[model samples]
Target: MNVDSPVFLFDQGIPGFENLRQFIFLEIEGNIPMRLMKSLEDQHISLLVVSPFFIYPEYEWELSEPVKQELLIKTEADVEVWSIVTLPAEPSQATLNLLAPLVLNRNEKVGKQLILHDSTYSSRAPLIRA
Candidate 1:
């Protein structure tokens, strides 16, 4: 990949798409908070992910030891967090998978989808707040 298209390596890949490991983020224009995470291994697989902080500033979670080591994350600055977004028929009905946030080690270009078992957050949290 070129400098403009740096790819993220998901060591174990995302949960359902385990076989596809490499991905690149395609930014969406026009003040959008979402991004298109396109798989390098498969052209057909693409996921819409959003920074949870943008939608919920209070959103927070701790990474397990295994996850931390796997990503080689050293500090908060070393990582970027994103949540999978699910768009429905209606724009307002879009939801984000808050229960499982995708964390990427920026310095290492490594990523992993982490499922929070102790959290109260839902897998499908509403995108638009009332």
Candidate 2:
């Protein structure tokens, strides 16, 4: 792990990979707006994520009180949201998982993948910037 990198703790880890806890957000070296969420415990566990608001300008979701308290989130500014990207053989065919967004508390350096039960958005939404 890079000493300079800020480690984000996921108390419950990701949905399927619940055992892995610690993660670090790495910026991709290029013009692409994507970020690499690398797991500290597993070298093979890295996810490509991007800000959902960049793709869907009007994208919005409500965080439950439990989630806010879990991450120690106090205000809207303390939160950051990211969507996992699924890239197919063709880059243009990539999709973003909007149904379950990764919500992070910037101040606390903790995060959780939140599943929106009442969301009309799809799990595989077209990755087109609006």
Candidate 3:
């Protein structure tokens, strides 16, 4: 991770967490693929996030033109995707919200949680393989 990683601005903020608009992605110590998305506005509002592709190799989606324009994404290389993970009381039950992925434009440092209108992905897809 870059020491000067830009703070991502979610203009409308994440759904259900509308109050949080700015966040920085922090790599969790000892967790290679997990990251802590810490909200700048609310210190306590941190989320565990990961690139869904790490667990689901086939994970893929086409960003709508509106989304691309909103994030100022000029090319495919400018996009980075991640999913919020829910850590259950039982660690093994941890799941990733694949239905609504966090799409960020690395170039603009802006992001949005895109909820698919219709998809096969689940909001609670298991983190680990069965």
What digit string (tens of lDDT, one per residue) describes model 1 on residues 12-100?
88999999999998888889888899998898998999999998999887788888898998898998999999999998999999999
Task: Evaluate residue 38 in candidate 3 and report its C-alpha lDDT on the 0 to 100 scale.
Answer: 85
lDDT of 2 by residue, 19-46 (tens): 9999998988888778899999999999
Q: For residue 118, what is the lDDT in candidate 3? A: 78
**Candidate 3: tens digits of C-alpha lDDT, residues 9-97:** 99999998998999999877885787888888887898999999999999987889999999999999999899999998999999999
| Every model's TM-score | 0.93, 0.93, 0.94
Q: List lDDT for all candidates, in order.
A: 0.90, 0.91, 0.91
Selected candidate, larger TM-score, 1 vs 3: 3
Error of 2 at 46 (Å): 0.7
Give candidate 1's error at residue 73 in angstroms. Answer: 0.7
Poorly placed runs, candidate 1 (over 4 Å): 1-3
Q: What's model 2's lDDT at 18?
A: 99
